[model samples]
Target: MSTKPQVSVAIQWATEADHPPFSELSNAQIRRWVRACFADSADITIRMVGETEGRQLNNDFRGKDYATNVLTFPMEMPSLGADSGLPTFMADIVLCTAVVDKEAKEQGKKPLDHFAHLVVHGCLHAQGYVHELESQASLMENKEIEILKRFRISNPYVLEGTK
Candidate 1:
């Protein structure tokens, strides 16, 4: 009786930077995080990289000079042709391990918890969700909050230990 969207998730750890073999960043956990955000089936690849590579990608693609916590690149929409039940959604979500860890400490949040939020945030962007406007941002944040609750994670925008 599961209505979750089916996704083909591939995890890639392109940067070793001491990010080895952690249960929090396991494939199952990543898949669950993405599934929680998707309304339709998707083919997603999540990659973790060091700050250098992250900065390079950001500068090359987005014209930014700094590494970010998460970056999502949505691929071209494919045809849902006859006899093709495969998902048309395709995207690659990249997490900069150093940046994420740094942000987690700065924000007083657990690294894994922040990772979950970023994954969900990136997934939503891949699905065409945006926070460029106030209303849209509110809607997206609310969606993220609800999704996080399923994993017993608190509202990310709210300070921990306060309500």
Candidate 2:
């Protein structure tokens, strides 16, 4: 018998918006994404912020001036215990709600669906996935597609006008 790794997610809403309810960022939803792409048990915090803070974080960490939909900050820490076979993963995922809302509208996608994709994408990054190269991007994208499929979400890379 196999067991899934345990995931603890703490969601922080740093910005105010008349968007969906906070329940949308449920633990089950987050655990599903984390488990799909990672083998280790994790402690993750997801923060929803406005464009200003998001842009500042992006600028400081990634050197990008504009705010991105999501940013993953993986933590470097020691293991919990030696006897525990599972590794402990810790990360902070920041979501720019305004950017997510804007991008969803522009892309003709549901906000919930787009949010789910970004969450999954950010979790994968916490597990060391990257898209800095063409091959790496393809691999990461394929993993995202498979995980999103389980959530009944279509491939996010497929835009509205594209075949």
Candidate 3:
């Protein structure tokens, strides 16, 4: 009677960095983090990339100029109706490992902990979560905190001085 959602995740590592080695960020670890966020069955691909690919994707799709920590590309609406019993949500979650490592160091957080946060964040985006508005951002941030708490992780939104 585990309450976890049925999420099928495919992990691809395209990064050449060694900050967080394969042993530190395994596919099972990624899948576990993403699965914790889903309330419905999902199909997700988690791709780890380097700065070049990350920057290119950000420029081409999001029109940004630098590599970001994570980008989620949710698939279009499925042709099959919701009643078809297929996966209800689908997306590709891209994580720039180098950026993630740097951010984690700057934030005074563990790399693996930060990785979990990004994976969960990206998965939520796949399920149509957004943080563009203050209200929406609050809700999304709270949800992330709640989910992360299940694994004994602290709130990512909290500033260093608060804790």
For candidate 2, write residues 1-163 as lDDT tens digits: 8777777778787746335633466656765666676666788888888888999999999999998999999998676584665457789999888899899999998887898899989988898889999999999999999989988999999987788
Quality of model 2 by C-alpha lDDT:
0.83
* Tens digit of per-residue lDDT, candidate 3, span 1-163: 8556678999888846445443566778777888888888899999988899999999999999999999999998666885787888999999998998889889988778888899989988998889999999888999999999998888887756785
Clashing pairs in 1: none
Q: Alpha-carbon error at 108 in model 2, in Å?
A: 1.4
Per-prediction TM-score = 0.89, 0.86, 0.91
Q: What lDDT score goes with residue 158 in model 2?
A: 97
- State the weakest 10-residue window (summed lDDT) of model 1: 15-24
Q: Rank by TM-score, descending? A: 3, 1, 2
| lDDT (Cα, tens digit) per residue for candidate 1, span 24-143 | 567788889988887777899999888888999999999999988899999988676724877757899999888888888889898888888999999988988899999999999999
Q: Which regions of candidate 3 are displaced past 4 Å?
A: 1-4, 15-18, 21-23
Q: Which window of ten consecutive residues has the lowest lDDT sum in model 3?
A: 15-24
| Top candidate by lDDT | 3
Name the lDDT value of residue 104 in candidate 1.
82
Candidate 1 overall lDDT versus native: 0.85
**CA lDDT, candidate 2, residue 156:** 95
The C-alpha stretches of model 1 lying farther than 4 A from their native spots are 1-4, 20-24, 79-83, 161-163
